[model samples]
Target: MKITTNMHEGRRTEMYACGAWNDMIITDYLEMAVTKTPQKTALVGYRVHAGDRSAMSYSELDRRITRMAAGLAALGVEKGDVVSCQLPNWWQMSALFLACVRIGAVCNPLMPIFREHEMQYMLAHAQSKVVVVPKIFRHFDHQAMLQGLRSELPDLKHVLVIDSDDEQSFEQVLLQRAWEEEVDTARLFAERRPSADEVVQLLYTSGTTGKPKGVMHTSNTLLSNIRPFSERQGLSATDIILMPSPLAHQLGFLYGLMLPVYLGATAILQDVWEPAFAARVVAEEGCTLTLGSTPFLADLVDIARDEREQQASLKTFISAGAPIPGALVEKAASVMQGTKVISAWGMTENGAVTTTRPEDPQTTAVHSDGVALPYMQVKIVDGEGHEQPAGEEGDLLVRGASQCVGYFRQPDMYQLDNEGWFATGDIARKDATGYIRITGRSKDVVIRGGENLPIADIENTLYKHPAIQAVALVGAPDERLGERLCAYVTLHDSSATLTLKDVTDYLVEQKFTRQYLPEYLEVLAALPRTPSGKIQKFKLRDMARDIFQGQASHA
Candidate 1:
């Protein structure tokens, strides 16, 4: 077994003493649900591609976790080893995560869309002992891809296949029924459960830098994130949670799997992201709360607009991972009544840091990212690391128990400064009452002749335009001015294509400063985005270098 457990023992003790880190681990709560309400519905998962619906009771889930754990032990998985999986929102993922905790392995869930390049870097970083991949997901033969790279992944001892015609099927090997009959699962698990302070999860950042960084979090740190949202929202066993986001991401994992189990609530998982299908599941399953990125919220609202009957049960909609346009927030009240369209901001390093309260003033959601959650703190700092006062745009920093422990296998690279705060690389401002408004990325902003162009403000302005469907503002390379703002826009079907003049005219009407106005406009079929739906601005920057250069070069 690898020694990846509890690297920062002093930090854990301090957090626990300060009431930031609760002593309870995740499995303890799962077991509580098992013991208290064994027959209660724990999960309802839909695999749209396979045309199947799977459900599990608390008792059944408990047994499956046990069996899977025993099976993993038999396959030579041990404490502190990495159990990497790339799956959709499936019941097997839920079981596999619990299975990992049962034997004290770290869970490293890769995005299903990740091809060989990302997989190579991450698998090598984690030194993953086992990797679970879909046999064929979204028409890509994942098994074949991994099989081709097996020689390169020296630490990979086993490959568990999911949903395929293979001898080493995940269901056949790990999740086989009645493993306790052959082995002492309870005893095996009892001997292996990791402490709450030990690193048990690895979530990779979809970085602009070529390689992704694996952000490590212990049980205490993760729970510090979940508990705040749960308490603030008053989540309980009665609430039904719906997840349209990828479970591999922290947003889905926290609310989809961990939160429901922690609260002993029923969680509904939708594997495929069809807005219409998502609406049906919400109605049919009586889902109350959903948390996802801005696009998911938009899709849900679009479906709710058309399919009125499917939205009656939804109480809360938490939008994160991207900026929430003020227009989207204002549209929500009338479009989807009786639901809180809460805006939030967070990262893989810091789980759900700031979030607008469900009962927060309507304008707050439209104007600000959110207020800091309990035990999670956020502050703005100047360039020299001095804390900036409210209403001044500066670098955002966070220090709290919920923050990630460090980067996976690269502790030295996780640069927490002398004050124990992690630099968030976001330019933001806090209101007098402590609401943070994300202005732009520290690295993503464009400067034209020593003046910073308001990229996010321009994007938000363009989003409100009737003709534009989606918009991205990138810093185009300019030799003299250093950089210039270039707007890439996608037009709505109902509208005519917008020219550079049309875009500038709209921004002018919106009262945008001439300095921040887009110098060039490029129409794109779609904005290049990560699989999780974040706009890949770096790609846009590269594309910007080739456009409208002669005008800037000669002038």
Candidate 2:
């Protein structure tokens, strides 16, 4: 599926002319590093519990990527084919993406947290030809799940499992042999070098109000953000990146995996978020930079305060997906003496569009998201489409080189205006100096840590319960995670009872992701509704906030 259009061509020309896009695919960068820094450490993966660590140099990693590409080709994967991978932050996950680039195929990375509920929709919608998963991750049998799903998805022809030595294991099939030598190297490069405009990533974002839409991005669009964003942050080949965020999310994919490759830098991957483990790794590796959500910073601060030596080598921490509280920023600065905590805001549609600068006051991130990167534009507009004055909260909209091409197989769902602006569904205010402060979301979303919960999907599932007559999901205040999901329900019969555990049990039985289950449940006689009978979620949100505040005060 080619995603290019006249509009895309026009954008590409504009971006290239202005140097927002350098017109180089990620594989080109990998090859450049292979020739220039062949012996440099390109990747370091840590599997803490399994007591395993792997490191690969640039040249060795490139060779492995080529072999992996040949393995995919041997499985009948070709140009434009979608290859989905549901793996953890292991070395193989990073290699798989680069291999997709080598073979000119679209790569779709699914979060390991996703179960049959989300996988069924995403795999079938993307029409993936190949899916790679772990034999078992976190005690869940991923191989079994995919095997069960295979019969339902006719497009899924191959299921390759990682962390296993079986016939279908990724290492056995893709790594044990030198398949690159068997393939016609000259013809493979000549026939399969993908253009920068071709869609390289298909990321399905958890929706706030509807089914997940597959966000499609090309090399030019993704690299557009990486180049300027990294430059502004003063990242270089000398710096080491310690990434604990999930590789499946854009935070880890763009920065943890792609950014290091782009800069010829080293990336240290941590598959799980253990603050003590992360702190130790950063010090041991001398990692200089990292990016994650507010919760990560909070946990790191807690650890650094107790073990100051663990975070001594850290230089930068960029927080996104939620507002950074001023108190937390102060605490982090106090504990990690030289580390700069930068604030940023963006979506899956576009990578980090705005971020606080290193030279700015430490408090700037507390008050505002930051100024837009050079290649992007941000504006706040009223309901009538007029630009709002500074300090006035309005709809947040953004557009630029980093904006995704369109939604996969759902062009009409993109809904960018004629001028190329995309509505962000966020309400925010812009200062006279252009920094934006996110006030609230026009869309109902519960941002637990850095992940957006699928509110509509969860609510719809709850509606199927025999006891529920009405249900509304809202985000409740939480200092560490920014927000925790709260569910308010009205029972079918006045005497019908419901408890938080009961609600969680039902959702789990329905295959809902455990991490997204509501932390609090409220049983009400009737949900607050407007005169016209529409549910007033704002009222429920306020109630949740009041209850949370009360609990905090009592404690």
Per-candidate TM-scores read 0.81, 0.98
lDDT (Cα, 0-100) at 240 in candidate 1: 96
Candidate 2 on 232-331: residue-level lDDT in tens? 9998999999989988999889999899999999999998888888898998899999999999999999998889878888999999989998999999
Clashes of each: 0, 0
The positional error of residue 321 in candidate 1, measured at the CA in angstroms, is 1.1
**Alpha-carbon RMSD, candidate 1:** 11.0
Question: What does candidate 1's lDDT look like per residue over 431-507, in tens digits?
Answer: 99899998877665665543335465567668999889999888875533546788888888734677899988877
Candidate 2's TM-score reads: 0.98
Judge candidate 2 against the unseen true structure and give its global Cα lDDT, from 0 to 1. Answer: 0.90
Error of 1 at 125 (Å): 1.5
lDDT of 2 at 523: 97
